[model samples]
Target: MTGWLDRAAENAHKFAQRNPRAVAAGVMFSLAGFAATAFGVASPSAPGTEIAQQIISEDVQPLPVHEQLEALAAHQLELNRSTAGRANDTADRLLSRLGVNDASAASFLRRERGVRDLLDGRVPRLFTARADESGRLKELVVRMPAERRDQITTHFTRVTLHPAGHGGWKVRREQAQLESQVRLGSGTVRNSLFTATDEAGLPDTIATQLSEMFSEEVDFHREIKKGDTFSVAYETLTADGEPITWNEGAGHLLAAEYINRGRVYQGMWVRDAMGRGAYVGMDGQPKQRSFLASPMEFSRVTSGFAMRMHPILQTMRAHQGVDYGAPVGTPVRTVGSGVVDFAGWRNGFGNVVEIQHDGDRSTLYAHLSRIDVRKGEHVEQGTRIGAVGATGWATGPHLHFEFRIRGVHQDPLQVAKATQTPMASVSRAELQQLATSARTQIAAARSMGAVRAE
Candidate 1:
């Protein structure tokens, strides 16, 4: 038997050597079959414990069809739409555009005095309306400029009309605190500052602030070159995150850079621990001089301190003050901090205000429609002392501003450049940090503007 087994093994080895590929394939197939039987398949369970089973039956009632339908209706779809209130936007018309078909909502809007005023102005207003999927009005809200002119910068008017809990619609009108949103913008002047700002999609208020921020170093009206550029980091006032259209949503100018006639000027707003803040330059000098450059925030220079044809006299005469053409109700501010020396009318300068400042200097604002200060009252720089009007011996509504030294008339434009020391309390580290951030922000704004231009 041993001899026979050895002969068979010798014969198998010879065959394997001749067909090595066939032998390897056969070995792999046998290993895979063994693995599949051992691990890949589950073992069967023993059938020793068999238990008896029983079946039971019952009937269950479902909810009523109406109740199921009511549950679905409770989650009715709500729709929202927004539109601007035009001068010709009636209650029905506005509601129609907002996808509302309810006549009761329109009637309620027409009946309420506060709500009706939303469509009274020619200036378009942003309106948001909520309704059901069936076009029934749910609520209407509109954010508008403040009613009082003085609060335009800090306040906004919010009007809401909705269904009252009792049943009929109720209108709510209130003055809301305007929240400030930080904004960055940049523009290059091709024609004018206003034009550039418009093209750059910047607010008009920012343009005015930029002009005022660099007024001491550059004359925006006369010295502005074609290629002048500006960058600004500022704030825009919003009510409930919605920007108010009127008054340009004006807020504080935080930082600014102006390139006027090839000279680069930069300013950053800085504050101390006392909450007092001011615009300062890169060298930490206050941009505010001894006085502000203009009484109004922004306006066209209709007349300068030169010999010009008098509108009333029809003869060429020396225009002692600058005339800023603006609407009648435009705010007129004090150019410097001072005590009111005169707050009554003069012969030609009707309803005038004269402030006596330090350093033997004084300033006068003429042709004011209303004066907010008395003769003995002390006023600060940039205080609204009055509003512009055509009450004087003049042709139209404008501000006649004059700067005087020792009772002699001087150029109003020159007063803003007068040397004044900066505040001493601001920390050096705080200002440096603020300047670094402002520098980066201005650069970013410029780059963004360039990208948009391209």
Candidate 2:
């Protein structure tokens, strides 16, 4: 019997070697069955057996009143305030308004020449101050326009005052570079362009650019009806992330869209290889015409080129030119690039300046307080040749602008519209990309304006 058992074991070992995978599967099946049987036979608890639970409660006590008061006293807060310097602002008054009662800071501000200069300008300067809980000034900063005329747009002046190592004070005055920030704005014309821009918080410079951008399509002076809308994306110069006041932080107008009388106009700024940039339509055509509709940057048309009662003559006569009502000394520019044909006092037109352009076209600017150009001088479009004045046979300050074709009087607005805007050869792909970006920005600005209105 022992020999027969040994022979059977030998046979089983040989079979396992021949079929290893089958042997492994059988072993796993047997283990699973064993586990199922063990679980099935597990003993059950006694009938009606139950667990127990108990509730616990206690009151938490805070620290003593004196300890709490000490903790509160250890944590002191600092306050910051900012305001613009007023014309009548004294050191003490300014400090008081900023919630600082420190006499030393006020004394320093008055005693330091640099600090006093920061507050001397008629235009307000931005002032920022920091103080402790006891109203003691810890730091003061003043920001204003750069003193250099060439750097006003590119730089800003910063004056700082703080406590030194000791109880004394340290002052610093420096010029910092201005940073350009891209901004978007949109508005609707309810009354006038200025009023709409004021409501929209847009800079006056940008508002003027918008008018110039679509001068050929619409007459901003007379044809701007109610319900007209516009959107703009522009660059604003900032000093340390704060918008500067001088020049209203004026920069470049990047892109603009205007809707007037159910007509839509859009333009995007495109630069050439020479680094010169201009506003162009989505089709890669320039928008700036050779002539501008208005001689001045922005003004109202007091009289049109038609029959009107002469203020001085007191007789109905044909008004050969358009009269623009503006304040005295308002800058008057040449409508188109040309040479000064005449620059002097005339019979009815005082301080007159006539510019002769190509194609037998000439423009006239009269009633000037001062003449900045001379006869035979070459002047470009938008060049300030003189200023608005009442020197001519006029009752008030205004600009008399006229456009002549072959010695014949023509409407200035009409002439501007008829003049063709020269288109420059540009890369179609580049212009299309720029126009696409401008469209996105303009849409965002419009949506933002709608949200604000809501």
Quote each prediction's TM-score: 0.55, 0.55
For candidate 2, write residues 84-167 as lDDT tens digits. Answer: 888888898888888898878888778877677766758658888889889988888888888664466668888888977455
Once fitted onto the true fold, the runs of candidate 1 whose alpha carbons sit more than 4 angstroms away are 1-78, 122-124, 147-149, 165-167, 271-277, 290-364, 367-425, 452-454
lDDT top scorer: 2
Candidate 2 scores a C-alpha RMSD against the true structure in Å of 27.9
- The pairs that clash in candidate 2 are none
Cα lDDT computed for each candidate against the true fold: 0.67, 0.68
lDDT of 1 by residue, 188-215 (tens): 7888787777766666556655665676
Model 2 per-residue lDDT at 72: 45
Off by over 4 Å in 2: 1-77, 165-167, 270-277, 289-351, 354-430, 449-454
Cα shift from native, residue 337, model 2 (Å): 8.1
